[model samples]
Target: MYSQLWCRTGLLGLLWLISAGFMSAQTPARTELTVTAMHPAADSPLRLGANFSLRIHYDSPAAFRLRIQGERQGTTIPGITHASPRYGPGAGEAIAWLAFDHLAQLDRILLVAEDAATGHVLTSLALPLTLTWSADAPPGAPAPVWVQELNQHAQLAITREMQAPADGGDDFWVNLFLQAVFLTVPGYIILQIALPWWTRDRWRKAAWAPLIVTVPMFLFVVFASTAGGSNLAPIWLLLVCPPACFYLVFLALFFWLKQKRA
Candidate 1:
């Protein structure tokens, strides 16, 4: 009876050890990412419209990909351009351009790890950055008109294991139509009326019009957005047309009243 009991106990211990080993072998290893080196280092301010490089090391699987994406309204829009290595995680150079403006001056770039086959975001990290731009520096490439139409107010947003947001909609077409009627047509009419009567000397003075209220207000809005939040999609004039028209009319009236008094 004692010999039989010893054989059974030994067999049970062997089975437990084999099961634990199998479970360990079945679990996938977690990947770790490290930025080994980067040019225009984190301390250095980035110039708007400039491209930069980063050298990164990771132990990611062949199925995983590291991507540079821009955050907008809690969702990410495709970044300007991120050319990362196609193969697995190893030391590699990332030459990417982040679209930016005054609002982006203090913003950080977003880097994410994704499972390519599953379209799920597994992890994310923010790359601290700041930007400065000269007037002549090219304007950042604006996101596609339709970008904003994506899940603007999505609750099921960026987090671990969530499927990536879908990127297709009719907002582009709708906005374009509205822009033509309210923005393009009205702008053309205003240009026709003003340009014909204005002298070359007036053009120089008019250039300062934006610097007075428009530029200041735009910058103020950008500052507020940086502190608050920002819309990732850009529909130029869609949001600006109505209010701008009101401002233009009031501006014209204000200038006329001052000139008459003078």
Candidate 2:
């Protein structure tokens, strides 16, 4: 009788241990939250004082909430400008229209996701951004007309007036004309005068080269000027002058080389 009782006790203890082990094996692992995509892209330019869209795609097994925080000089900028479906579970996307009302200088933006139930941080992402005027506007200027038009159609209300008149002004016409003249004059000079006069038969084959190389940049400047604003004089100098000078030097080198060989 004593042996049977001891055997029965051992059997019960073994069964308890087996059940505990099974329970431990059945428990689910904690799911890690991950961000998969963002819009306007990382390291892309953002026009200051404009309403821009930010979209984030993420995956999570548990319920989560997302928040965007913009900081300049370590201080938070307030105003819940825009966002959609801020909280949910599993894999999903969130979008927001953010305005930089107070962005006098460049600001750092943080996208933070947290566990909804426990209020613990799940994941955080940093967006490398530059809050500047579009390649056309002057530094520290308000958002441009095209940008403002974009905002008027968006969820946010942008209040800045369009600086350029609808009828277009003398300054606008003068700038446009100068841009065209600048692009055309250089090409004409290189193709008609400089290349023919300077380079020989063998090197002349590459005469169209300078115009071909610089035309794309010229077109880009024209497009930027039209869409961004009429004030692209500074940008024109930065884009056109250095490359033009370099191309001239390259042509000179080629001429010298060909002449030396001849």
Candidate 3:
């Protein structure tokens, strides 16, 4: 019986060590993303006229490609003239231009992207192709009325409205997180204190008390000082100083009590 118990204890210890290591490794780590482009607009379904340009934006740095597949009905056409690469972590843009001497016909097109290092396809977005231009009036017919002035003015007005704000969602989220952290820590600290008193587990009660009370309060102060207000930082920091110092006193008290009991 003694030998059997010893063997079981050894196996349990090994299992616990493995479990602890796994839990530690599971902590969050940063990740890097690769972005690339796959297809060009010339091969798109719209079969745009030779006079056109395609612009693409990527969220990360990686090898990009633009594939044009189609035929031109008109005389000799000018092929792709220039290619450029942009770099950034969150966003980047690419511009490709196509020019032709005379009007041309086109068929289908595709776009694709892949990781430069691993050669893995990351993202692909197909764009609709379109081309429209006026043909010469019939021999006897009069020219159609064109409204270039009003259209140009309206386009400029609309472009300004579209570029107003990047995104409002992030501001709301940061505010919400700050509020939750504010409310949660105080309650958690209170519960920690109540349980230890109720159960008479001095060590556990003491061990969790300082963390439960201090960590949340510290995070709340950070969020409030940084995200809460405008530029009145010096005053806010001064106002928050007393409460933080008081919390530290409580932490010391708990530690002293725990040590005495132990």
The candidate scoring highest on TM-score is 1
Which ten-residue region of model 3 has the weakest summed lDDT?
137-146
Report the lDDT tens digits of candidate 2 across residue range 1-262.
9999999999999999999999988975443434443344444455555554565556666676566766667766663455323344556555545655443434666777767665566777766565432544333334445444433433232122133433468868877866775675455445445765677675676665656656676677777777865444335545555555556667777788867997
Question: What are the per-model numbers of colliding residue pairs?
Answer: 0, 0, 8
Ranking by TM-score: 1, 2, 3
lDDT for each residue of candidate 3 in 1-262, tens digit (9 for 90 to 100) = 9999999999999999999999988853322222233222223322223324444555644444333222334322344433323223355454344433344444322344544444344565444444321233122222112223322333554465345334567766876765655554454455555544544455445545455445655566677768975333333333344454445446557766876798
Instruction: For model 3, state the Cα shift of residue 16 in Å.
Output: 17
Q: Candidate 1: RMSD over Cα atoms?
A: 19.5
How well does candidate 1 score on lDDT at residue 184?
44
| lDDT of model number 2 | 0.57
Q: Of the candidates numbered 1 and 3, which has the greater TM-score value?
A: 1
RMSD per prediction, one decimal?
19.5, 21.5, 21.3
Model 3: colliding residue pairs: 37-112, 38-112, 38-113, 39-111, 39-112, 43-108, 43-109, 44-109
Residue 2, model 1: lDDT of: 92
- Candidate maximizing lDDT: 2
Model 1 stretches astray by more than 4 angstroms: 1-5, 70-79, 83-85, 89-103, 128-262
Which tens-of-lDDT digit does each residue in 177-237 have in candidate 1?
6656566436633743564354245643553353354444556567656764544222333
Error of 2 at 254 (Å): 99
| Candidate 1 TM-score over all chains jointly | 0.42
Which sections of candidate 3 miss by over 4 Å? 1-50, 61-78, 86-89, 114-122, 132-262
Question: Each model's TM-score?
Answer: 0.42, 0.35, 0.26
- In candidate 3, position 205 carries an lDDT of 51
